[model samples]
Target: MTVVEVLFLLLGLVAAGSALLVVTTRTMVHAALWLVVTLGAVAGIFLLLAAEFVAWVQILIYVGAVVVLLLFALMLTKAPTGPQPDLDARRALPAVAVAGLVLAVLGTTVVAGFHGVELDLDGAVVGSAQTTGATIFQQWVLPFEVLSVLLLAALVGAIVLSRGTGRRGGE
Candidate 1:
């Protein structure tokens, strides 16, 4: 109906289509790239919703850090650059069913919760960087630190797995 609604719908379609490609693509690198696109579309949606902080975080954390990490890992591990031959399509039906069910439930909940409700964006400061930073530092510091440590550990693990005992020249 409105321009914002039209833009939101377009972004939603992009996000959904890229997400589907992320899961269905046979190439690992392509899948990771598609995931980046999906995340970027989600960030666009957040920007449309007037959540600037969240949009930038989504771009920085997901599209920048996570996807780059994934691509780095793929390269480090010498993963196949082309389409995989062993990709299984047997689970597609079940996966689609589950995805449809989840989407239906979430759609129902959102419609019921916000039925005919209009958001007043004027003077709203909830998604500002100051507010988000304070909330993260004050309330989510420990979990955030723990997650950082976990990601570091995973990166180290991937490197270790790729290197494999460090023996060279038949030593």
Candidate 2:
């Protein structure tokens, strides 16, 4: 096939593998780090699709903010640094079955939707920053503001949780 197709396949493999690791890893910190890999792979796929704005946003929002937040929360909560023995392989079969089922559904839907269809990339500017920004501000402003508020609240909650109620020496 084409080089782009090969690259897309590679990125998809990376994303899928990392996503599996994110779910299976016993260490919380390692899982978060694996999530970063998964997100970075997705961003790379976005870039390969010529969606520059989406790629950058994926990197910034997911890899930068979300993963960092997860790591911070893990650290603040004093989570275990080693492999958790409690997390056994008992759910592996069920998890794999569910994943396979979802993948089958998605693949079927995609094939049906795009059957015999070809994309015309000429003069297409859907992924441009200007277009994305205008759409977000014009039609998605309320949701954007609500998400910002939610993030702010989560940040505050993390800080509060990290700082325990016990008084310090100065107090």
Candidate 3:
């Protein structure tokens, strides 16, 4: 197809591979790092799709804040950073089967729904900041504010819990 399609496919592959790594990696820290890679790849895909606002938001919110929050929580908790045998031994077959089934159904639905529809990228409006801001502020104000408050609460709670634990494991 076009160059953009090729780049989109490549980015999609990168995102999918790293997302699998995020789940399958034995170490918690490594998983978080892989998630960063996956999110970055997704942002690249959004950029290629000409959604500049969304791409930057993905980079800022997910890659910057969420991943940093996860990493901070992991470090502060002193959780195992290495592979754990008991965790490794948990049954994965059922999960894999379920994931495969879901993928198959979704893929089929997408193909069926979009079989003949062609996108007109040349005629589409560029995703502008003013439009996006207006749309969000007008339609999604409550949800957006609620999400912000939730993230703030999570950050506060993590800090408070970390501060409360003493040297004797809070005994």
Candidate 4:
């Protein structure tokens, strides 16, 4: 097989495996770590698909910022530094059913959409760093600003919640 195909298969497996671990792992911290893996694999897949802008954003926003925030929250809340409680199969069954339904629908839609469509990306430009930066700054500036504002708000909210014990003195 071609190099691209091999890379795609590897990244796809990593994404899928980490996604499964994210759901299956009992420890919240382990789940977050697995989610980081999943997000990084997704970024790799985006890079392979020639969407460098999306790939970088995936790395910067999800793996870098979001996961860091998650870890911070875990630390602030003093989540068990050890393994989490075992999964309850009864409670998880419903979620599993819903996930299966959604996955089936998505799979059907993708298969139908790509039934006859063949991609020919031989001429498309795999965007450069400068060009991608210019496009985001010039065209997608509003969304970037919005994302930054949202992140700022989340940070402030987490700090507020963590500090609000509501006890003025020793009780």
TM-score each candidate. Answer: 0.74, 0.74, 0.79, 0.80
Clashing pairs in 1: none
- Prediction 3 global C-alpha lDDT: 0.87
* Whole-model lDDT per candidate: 0.89, 0.88, 0.87, 0.88
Comparing 2 and 3 on lDDT, the stronger one:
2
| lDDT, model 1 | 0.89
Residues forming the 10-long window of minimal summed lDDT in candidate 4? 81-90
List model 3 lDDT by residue over 68-160, tens digit each: 989998998896977865655478899999999999999999999999998656656666677789888999899999999998999898778
Q: Give me the runs in candidate 3 sitting further than 4 Å from their true place.
A: 138-171
Mark the regions of model 2 whose C-alpha exceeds 4 Å error after superposition: 120-123, 138-171
Give the alpha carbon lDDT tens digit for every residue of 15-124 in model 4.
Answer: 99999999888888898899999999999989888888889988999999999989988888888867767644758879989999999999999999898896555667
Per-residue lDDT of candidate 2, residues 63-153 (tens digit): 9988998998899889989999776576678978998999999999999999999665455665779878999999999999999999899
Task: Give the clashing residue pairs of candidate 4, or none.
Answer: none
- Report the Cα RMSD per candidate: 3.9, 3.9, 3.8, 3.3
Pairwise TM-score winner, candidates 1 and 3: 3
Best by lDDT: 1
